[model samples]
Target: MPREGLEVENLHLWRGEHHVLRGVGFALPRGGCLHVTGPNGAGKTSLLRAACGLLYPESGRLLWDGRDVHEDLPTFHSVLMYIGHEAPLKADLSARENLRYWIGTRRRIGRDTLGAALQRVGATAWSERPARTLSAGQRRRVALAALSLLLVPLWLLDEPTTNLDAEGQQLVGTLIEEHLARGGLVLAATHHELPLPRSRVQRLELTHE
Candidate 1:
């Protein structure tokens, strides 16, 4: 077996003294993908949050490339991108402006790549429209476009296909495939089935007792 790209050992999490996750553990190799599926309140979001260092685990370990992710958050974050259920775009800014601002804030990509990213997401039509004026699907595209400009290896997405139309869904599916082909890893939590290779994916379910 190859070394795991991401791992969680005996992970446990809680919310206000209520246990949410119970000793959940799994490992994915480099270039692997995992789809976490479960009913609402099954700790799916909590698990992703904990793994990405956004939430602290009550007990357990999260390792990236065999090293403790919490030990050096900066380095770990550099290799990872976490997109949560809520869109992180600024509603006041235009689609293009949002991407431009994020890129400038992170300085992750060059100025020249901005237009290309917007074009990739099919946001060229309304790139100049304020995010508030755009539909939910359009906003999500902007967020995805931001991710494309970065060079991260691990992508943790939550309901990434939500609010997307058929074409948008296919677009996202293609993006994931491309990511995996590049030896990158993806751990996504979705409520709907995604059109992707099931052989290279594993399903994990979280439920309450």
Candidate 2:
């Protein structure tokens, strides 16, 4: 039988002359969460990008259920979602329209579903406002709302709590817990500690080498 969940083995990445990841490896089963924490330039974001196939590594393999992800990139991507350091919303678009466009790329979503996702992340109040007019925290909320709309199994988030107050941060924790409860896997790279239960989170601290 195949091993369940995500596994990274002997990952090595280079950006020009600089080596970012140095043979990193880990295994995360269903309902698992991995928190990657480190200083800036520790390759935290790089690892997430690599895992989700946005950036390929010089040497390594990402396995889902004991099979190589590169074998079928499209199929692997269908089950993966990656949210980078910057929110991907369009500056000219309203929050609602942004979700519709973003979520529409992966799957079709209705207005009611978009509204519910925004409401879940506490961004429904300004869902009609232009993305440029929203505050950083509000934009982050919109990003989370987009995340909620996706039903993928693996989530790769970079600095998920970058611009949020205490309540908003807790909201992220709640959403993550709910996702994990549904047998989803989350790997988040953040500078500050996430407001999640320690028991459900497995931490990986990266360092400058």
Best by lDDT: 2
Which run of 10 residues does model 1 get worst, by summed lDDT? 103-112
- lDDT, candidate 2, equals 0.92
Writing each residue's lDDT as its tens digit, candidate 2 over 126-204 gives: 8888999999999999889888999899999999998899999999999899999999999999989888988889999
| Candidate 1 global CA lDDT score | 0.86
Q: Give the TM-score of candidate 1.
A: 0.95
Which lDDT value does model 1 have at 34? 90
Query: lDDT of all predictions, in order shown?
Result: 0.86, 0.92
Q: Candidates' TM-scores?
A: 0.95, 0.98
